[model samples]
Target: MDEFTSEELLEQLQQLDEQPRIEAKRASEIGKSVMQTICAFANEPGLGGGYLLLGIDEPSSVHESFTVCGVTDADTLLNTLQGNCREQFESPICVKGQVELLDGKKVIRLFVPELAPSAKPCTFKGKFDSKNKRKTGIWRRGLNGDYECSQQELEPLLLAKSGTSYEQIQLADAHWDDLDLSVIALYRTLRSKVRPYAEELQASDAEMLYALNLVRKQQDEWVPNVAGLLLMGKPLALRRLLPSVRVDYVRINGTKWVEDPEHRFATTLDLREPLLRLIPKLEATITDDLPRHFRLKEGDTQRSDEPLLPHKVIREAVVNAVMHRDYQVNQPILVVRYSNRIEIRNAGYSLKPEATLGDMGSKLRNPLIASVLYDLNFAETKGSGIRTMRRLLKQSGLAAPVFVSKVIENEFVATYLLHQLLGEEQLNWLTQFSHLHLTDDEAKALLLTREIGAIDNAGLRAITGLDTLSASQVLGRLHHQYHLIEQGGASSATYYQLAPQLQNDDQLPLFSGEAEASSEPNTSDLGTDTSDLGTDTSDLGTDTSDLNPATDTDLPEKLSQKIEQLTPKARRDKLWPVIVWLCALRPYKAEELATQLSRKETHLKHSHLNVLREQEKLIDYLYPEVINHPSQAYKTTDKGTNWLKHQGIEIE
Candidate 1:
């Protein structure tokens, strides 16, 4: 019974909207906004974790000028919405509906949370609605953005929600012996524990089976339901009954389409037995051994068993996928093995809203299947599988498992980082050189630059949760560490990049041997010698093609100082007019610039274009030789004349 006040909920709602993983509906309605926003947010990337504010108006205004336009029928709408949501959503949607008085007006704040990993994206109506169907469809949060689920995505996700197989139904021709006796025994053991009056009901095995709805007498013959056959039927019988409902397993070494895999296995396994077997085998492949003797004991006491994979964590993840996967979706569960990680992707999006992943509650999409698994000792009763996995991974010193629910694609993918496989060298490199001391926002900024090769301040601000000052300090640290090089200015005009010399030595040749000699006034300006890889040729492409060619002689003096002093943007902006005139004679591509200037690809992207635009020194010119619509080149602009004058260039 965690209680959040209306004010708290409003604050949370605002935070969510500011960084929503999905599309947020901008409105002030009470119940309708709550439900629709919850659904839309739930159908967002991770399924759940969203809010609906009743008082806040669209197009945010200052608080003093704000008005709280409350909902009509607040009480009645709250109850109706809660009841309807409970009935409609597969998982119990915990809603905090409250009325708050702001400026003497009553506003209802509804906080709809995301479902647990087990629960998937659920729709209110029992019809197909694609996420892109804007006017009609819905989807949960996906990694990239909101996307409509393909039929292949939707069916399995929905079927998994209830965790029931076709075998649950009583069949007309099946008998007790036709079912797997071992499976039956397991089921009985589970049922006894799950059911309260198991010992009191002194019924025979066949009678117990009948009461459980595994068997039924119809037209003078005993039959099983789809649920009965799927759960308790013999493997051969189950296959014959539902040939399409099978788990496909494929294992490959490395990550490419190339066929040079270290090992590969592909098979269609029976739902129950194969899952049980697959678990152990997957763990075996991912395991490695330590020295076996950390501390020398008297004799054999030094030996210990270490699993290659985090058994308990991976088991729960796989079990959740198997038991709760949408059985209706006939797609295969993919387990992609890579050199460093394992990706287990199942057919279904999370039913819970985005927020539930961080909370301490459970939501079951397939209560029946979950119950069956619980009895069989395959799963827990309290629904803490996700929490358990997280705890275990964290304890094992591995990165927290990444849980993602995509409603648009109708799938749930969990990534498990194999700490053992990362090796001491890789781990040392990542932890020591990875800038771990940096804040989460700072780390994110580094990652963005790493992935994209270049990043502007605005992009850094958006990705890293840093304020202006913090981001600047973080970027400065990266620059100081030689992990990143600044292109452009010290303030808003800056962009950051991985320094070429600091990058792998093998990559230095790509930027070429030509480099501008240190323009540093002395040892103080040149903080460190990064010239080990090669010479510093920062002015390789200086254009003597200035409108007043005589003014170009001054460029040599400007090139004398350290490159850091000539802010990346400033250098480009100041030289934009000269470069544009050079390009006017013969068009040059990005690669050409990089090759001619002896700068890395990263440096070119981070500094070149933005600098050209900053001083208004260049104008766009179409490439006459190319037939491309966007074919353009940079040329001298009228502003270049003034900029050259400012640089103290005299006109002849």
Candidate 2:
């Protein structure tokens, strides 16, 4: 682990709360929670392990700051921690511990180094659940904290231990015929254009595929692996084999998501072609739908029409989504086109940390797929895609794209606003805040939050060209001093949105009431036949009447039964799914949810509600921008619904 002093560690805890590589515990004595964190630090693949500061308490809602509650018996705590590390796991782990003085008190600083790949998956000795095959004692670090892994979540660790990737796995039912010859030929043609004498081009089909590691011999016959099927599989084969591996392009008439069944979307198209053909088709579909601007170059007689968003920027965004997406997920990539922005939501979070997204290195989840795209000049192999997009968007005078990478949710969303960062209308909006005498950068930050509904340090840095510290300070002033914005989330996941007073009437509709009052078709006109085109037209409406606190007579039977069986002593994990189900039925206030669950309101908000909404991305505030609104409540998001489906829990 990188070296750091006690002073530096304390500073991090105070400023950023908890980080991926740092944890604070008031461990007067070593316990299960501490041991789990140690295991997580050791097992996380690329974390390089983390530091645990004993005798420090995490910031709570009441505290609002980390407190240094020094250790009472440092010698005893050290002995217990060391003993547990050696004897409690499947393999012995080596750690470094030291007793240090901070604020005139004693504390223990321990660093847990990540185990080697061959010795990974450091599971507890006797914690396996026999009844459930999915339960392993393995732990991995997440954005929220350490979490136990299910069998499905353990595949990456096992693959790393065996020195292989998911792409190299040969599917049992796959055959040589699953590969498309025409796509293979297209690859050869594209490769030749890049390199006329490429050695792979000189080889036959089987030889070429073998050279690319796309095919492996299994049971005396060469068959396509996951990478091969993803790159060149026929549409029919993909539908039969990997039915969820497709792209959905949705066009909406307004600026935000619509959940009403009648007018949720304007034009919907789903494409399941192979990557080689699919990329160009997606590009064309998006480019054709974008608003155009005419430009006449010097000495040209006729004007040329170009998209408002740079074509290069759009191409890079599309290519980056497919090239870096996690194929292990059973969900489709969604490209949503709103009136003012385009959002590409993919399954995988970035392999690199969100802070260093545009840094000069590549962290590949699917190296084989990325290799092909790189060779064809479809993507940058050195992590320059984001940088390229930013540069092109700047040249076009558009607001910098905002990227939200949620690790716990296992999702990433890239939002590109279609208008200039500070256009005439935006300047007019800024006039409202001129009496406060804000700086240019501060004004830009506020305007960005108004346009996109939220802004973070990274986003502020992207638009104003400020470093991390400066951007954070600007946001700090706006949130604390001026009170123009309200902050949500913690540490690196933190974000700020317009405060309740500043969420003016000019803001666009976030739900389906006034937004759908136009001449759009009603529920009866738009039939419920969504299966024909794979379009998701289901009514995910935010109707909260059934479970209203005023009359709680109409709860779904499954939900009602689950609520009736709840106990006060139940674990938070057990309550999480139930809470999601409840919110799916209707938005619920924190106090109301607490009363239903038989927990204290303050405890529920601090322990469960805040974590679910800010950290997990499972639930979101009903009035997100106006967070302190009188009727503020929590509702389930699409990610929360997907998580429920994965857990095999169905709510009618």
lDDT of each: 0.48, 0.78
lDDT for 549 in candidate 2 is 69
**In candidate 1, how many Å is residue 586 off?**
40
Worst ten in a row by lDDT for model 2: 509-518
Q: Highest TM-score: which candidate? A: 2
Q: Which stretches of model 2 miss by more than 4 angstroms?
A: 1-4, 46-48, 60-62, 126-131, 258-262, 353-356, 359-361, 381-383, 404-409, 461-472, 489-493, 505-550, 556-593, 599-652
Q: How many clashing residue pairs, candidate 2?
A: 0
Per-residue lDDT tens digits for candidate 1, residues 1-652, read: 2455555544433332123422223233334434556665654434336555565544354543224566666677677777877876545577766767755766666666665434765565654555543233344443222334445445444544566443354444555555677766666665666674674246766676676565776766566665566566676665565544444333333332122322222211123243334344434333321111122336775544344345677668667777767555444455555434456667666766433654565676555555556655677556678778878867666555655554444566665545422334333334645544765555555544543344544445444435434555667666775455555322222466656753432221111101111221112212222231122111111222332322224344433232225343555444454454444434454445455445665466345543453213243322211111122234433344455567654333
How far out, in Å, is residue 498 in model 1?
11
TM-score of each: 0.44, 0.82
CA shift of 342, model 1, Å: 2.0
Query: Once model 2 is optimally superposed onto the true structure by TM-score, how far is the C-alpha of residue 418 displaced, in angstroms?
Result: 2.0
Best by lDDT: 2
Error of 1 at 154 (Å): 9.9
